[model samples]
Target: MQSTASTPELYLAELPEERQHIMTALRDVIRENLPAGFEEVMSYGMLGYAVPHTLYPAGYHCDPKQPLPFMSIASQKRHIAVYHMGMYADEKLLDWFKEEYSKHSNTKLDMGKSCIRFKKPEQVPLALIGELASKMTPQEWVQVYESQIKR
Candidate 1:
């Protein structure tokens, strides 16, 4: 569920106890695998990784005031979600993510253009998430985003 919690600690505290461990594990995977130059912050009311303005200055193309978001993890009304912006640009990555997720997970992967949805921690494929997380450096993300914008 979308929360009023401003910080990651508060966000974690507000989640159902049963959900906390899963969320923490997913957050850990993102944190551990994310490249340098990406900052973790609350964005779109979720735990988000973004390209900070100090580094990019361009901000997000859609909203210059906001950082360029790479990914976000949040508890939604019915499911947990990880929004991976990279997949929208790289269809191969999206396909590979789905294939790997299916190979590793017992649960069906319910995904949209950029959002992967799952009911529980077990539904998530942590290894695939880590591989995706590790693949994009902030510079690569910027290039990908810029390319999309130019098109």
Candidate 2:
């Protein structure tokens, strides 16, 4: 569900108490392992990590006014989701994640192009998510976005 909350803190606070804990843990892991240069912000109603305009004035090709998004975590209606733009843009990265997922959790990987869905909060692999967050720097993401995904 799209949240109307104005800030990440508010967004977390708005979730149900049980969800608040899961989202908070996931957010913390992403924040701790994410490379330098990514700014945490409220993007598309979720907790987003992006390359600020100062770092990439070109911004997002889809919306220049918005910072270039790198990753995001949200509590969706039926699951908690982690979205990594890098995984979508880089086939190697996607393959690596798919392989590593099996080593991290007993549950099958539930994923889409970029979104990793966890139907049960307990099944979420915080360490794996943290490693994924660290896999790309903002500069690297900008490069990938431009060369591969941007129109």
Candidate 3:
């Protein structure tokens, strides 16, 4: 469901304590490594990293009214979830991410096509997450996203 939240602070205020802590840590990592053109906003009832219209006016193909979503983090009922749009379109990145995750994290990788789930912040591979987030500039991500839309 799309969030009625218009700000990050509002999103954090609604999360439970444990979820707040986890999301806080992950948010720190994201804020630190997020590229220049990406902006953090609340979308789909979660924290979203997006390409503002100024950067990619076409917006997300699914909903042109919204900005293009690069990634999102949410506190699900069962676990913390990370949605990485990059891996969905890039097989090489997916393979590399999985291999790197296995090498770095002792916790079993619980992942969907693009969503990575973990219960605790300690289970996350901080370096891997940072590296992945910083892998592409806004322009590069737009190219990758557009390529998929074309096919």
Candidate 4:
């Protein structure tokens, strides 16, 4: 996977037409709902939104130079994934969302700590996804992280 650590927008501009279409749509939807301080970024070879710097000086565990992200979108070899960091990392929240997810879709999506994989964008419920994205803000996220770190 190529890294677009610098010039993320330019990088996205160069993606394959099909991938670009999906990324653009996902990026726009995510951008529209993001909380303050979050900016567009290219991380892990995909388009992701993150806190610019105010809250997290060192982003995720893997990349410490940027602000840690709350969510992200990636184009995989076979599918795209929208990552909801808090949901998967937070047991209570994940369980709550699992119940909620089941109510609307019978399909059981594959999940990793915070990543939810979807074969296509249509499979994701935009409204519910928006709610999930809006559930926590950078400030609230930092507070949660700090408290957890203290443990």
Candidate 5:
């Protein structure tokens, strides 16, 4: 995966064939589920969706040119990771998501603080992933970032 400095289109074009397939599928799923404020961009060597600053000036703090990312999709060496912003401060929701994932996914879903890692596309539960993606609204994402700083 290329760095965020790479243009989103270039990054997509440069992805390995396998990773490109995974990224494209993930991108379509995410785009279909996320709200209107979410715009695709390259961040941390992956595709990420963020809110435009015109909607919230304070959304871009560290980088005035970039908006606040709520979710991201990365191509790791052995797997793809779906990064969720909800884990930043919402432990209860995070735990609930983990439990829900495990309950329905038969223990195949692997997750960390915010990233859900999986090697094969078949291993991913599309419906459950969609549910998880829907949890963090733009307002909830801003709250998570603020609470993260407090901690």
Candidate 6:
């Protein structure tokens, strides 16, 4: 479910107690591993990592006032989700993630174009997620967004 929380801390606080640790861990992993230039912010009511306007003043094509989103994490009704725009814009990244996920997780990967869903918190592979977070730099993401996804 989309959260109305204004800050990352508030977003974490709003999560159910059982989900707090995993979500916080996911946030920490992303923060520690994401390449420099991506700022952590609350976007679209979720915890978001984005290329700030200072870096790319064009901002998001869909909403210029908002930063260009690179990744986001949210607690859905039935699952916790990680959305990585790199996987959606780059097929090789998607293929690599699918392959690596098989190696790291015993459970089948549940995913959409950009959203990776984990129904069980124990099944979340933190290290793999960290590696994925580190895979794309903000400049690279902005380039990809301009070339591939932006209109």
lDDT of the candidates, in the order given = 0.88, 0.93, 0.86, 0.71, 0.74, 0.95
Write the number of the candidate with greater TM-score, choosing between 1 and 4. Answer: 1
lDDT of 4 at 98: 79
Instruction: Give Cα distance to truth, residue 78, candidate 2, Å.
Output: 0.5
- Compared with the true structure, the alpha-carbon lDDT of candidate 3 equals 0.86
Best by lDDT: 6
Residues 14-131 of candidate 1: C-alpha lDDT, one tens digit per residue: 9988789888998999889999999998887899999999888999988899999999999887888999999989878887787778678887678888998987667877777888
Q: Candidate 1, after superposition: displacement of residue 137 in Å? A: 0.6
Q: Give each model's clash number.
A: 1, 0, 1, 2, 0, 0
- Poorest stretch of ten by lDDT in candidate 5: 1-10
The stretch of ten residues in a row with the least summed lDDT in candidate 2 is 142-151
Residue 85 local lDDT, model 4: 71
Ranking the candidates on lDDT from highest down gives 6, 2, 1, 3, 5, 4
Residue 30 CA error for candidate 1 (Å)?
Answer: 0.8
lDDT of 1: 0.88
Candidate 3 C-alpha lDDT tens digits along 1-151? 3456778888887787766776788888988898899999888888989999999999988899899999998888777888989899889999989889988899889999889998776787777888889877889889999899999
* Candidate 2 residue-wise lDDT at 42: 93
Candidate 5 structure quality by residue, lDDT tens digits, 1-151 = 4455467667667777877776777777788888666678777677888876766677666776778877888777788788887664688778788788876676466777778898776676667666777777777777777777667
Task: In model 6, state the lDDT of residue 100.
Answer: 96
Q: How many angstroms is residue 18 displaced in model 2 relative to the true structure, after the best TM-score fit?
A: 1.2
State the weakest 10-residue window (summed lDDT) of model 4: 1-10
Query: Tens-digit lDDT track for model 2 on 14-42?
Result: 99998999899999999999999999999
Error of 2 at 110 (Å): 0.7
RMSD per candidate (Å) reads 1.2, 1.0, 1.4, 2.5, 2.4, 1.0
Instruction: Rate residue 13 of model 3 by lDDT.
Output: 78
